[model samples]
Target: MSSIYLVLDMQNDLVHAGGPNGKSPLGEQVVARDVVNKTARAIAKARDAGVPVAFVRVGFSPDYRECPKGSAVFSGAPAAGIFKLGAWGTEIHPALGKREEDALITKHRVSPFYATDLEVLLRTLGVKRIYCSGVASQAVVQATVRDAHDRDFDVVVLEDCCAGPSAEEHRNSMQSIARFCRTESSEAMRFETLI
Candidate 1:
């Protein structure tokens, strides 16, 4: 079975130190976990192991037309002036070293698979197992695990590569998703083994 690394929601608004989330607890955990650097190393390892990498970003148009109204999570995007596509906040953080050949999956809502081409891309890549890592473990990471599991795809989540609103929240979310997927830290997961 082929595997792909699906890195989610590492956009500036969510993980960068200067972004809005930078002032939030999520940012604290992000920095504390050193996710950007660790994920960068992991990406390099994946590339070395010949594992394809895909990045999932949540963004909306300048007018926010693609954004869903009354979404508890995304409702504030328009008013807050964040998550606008083509904006720095929505762009993947520079530390990840995204390449043009890497698959970029853009979504409007919390779930990358929701109304997005993520599943299609997975199928196209002949990917049967997804190695997942992302921000806000309570949201996108868990959603990816659950949805991908439901779609009959094997899922492995890198615990250290993910963060949440708080440390406790991140742990709790990881525990919740453990039911649907395997969880491992970036350091312990060997990309070649998964491939």
Candidate 2:
């Protein structure tokens, strides 16, 4: 099946050790999982296999106009002054070795497909399946996987290339997601087999 790999929310603030959210208790767990290197390797493998890649990030306007005040997940963002557009925190983590040819999508919500051009891009690219890897498996990864599945796209979760605030959360999310999508480590994906 024709496929694209999505590297989701591996932004500096969410993954890097020195970024805004990087020092948070949850960030510590993300950092400990070494998802950056794992995701980087998955990107490399996808590129080598000639699969298109898309980088998805979450960010808001400078005035925080797009941020919702009632959502607990993002309510603090405006006050915290993080994830603003053009800010270093919103940039993709440097460790991923992003390429100019890859597509970039900035989103305001958990699911990459929500209010984003991701669906259009996927359709434009004729993407039949998506390989997902990202930080906070229980959040963005889970949301995106279910949304993608609902959108009628075959979805695969690169489990090793994803992390969460805790091991249990990660494990539980993966277990639940298995009902909707296939879950595998980056090493097990074997791009050649898919082709």
Best candidate per TM-score, number? 1
Estimate, for each residue in 1-195, the C-alpha lDDT of model 2 and write its tens digit. 368999999998889988876777668777677788888889899888888888999999999999988998999998888889999999899989988988999999999999999999988877888888898788999999999999898898899888888888889999989988998889888653244
Per-residue accuracy of model 1 over 62-153 as CA lDDT, tens digit each: 99998788889988899999999988998899999999999999998788999988888888877889998989899999989999999999
150 in model 2: Cα distance from truth in Å? Answer: 0.8
- Candidate no. 1 TM-score: 0.96
lDDT of 2: 0.87
Q: Return the top candidate by lDDT.
A: 1
TM per candidate comes to 0.96, 0.95
Model 2: residues with Cα > 4 Å off, grouped in runs = 192-195
Clashing pairs in 1: none
Lowest lDDT 10-mer window, candidate 1?
186-195
lDDT of each: 0.90, 0.87
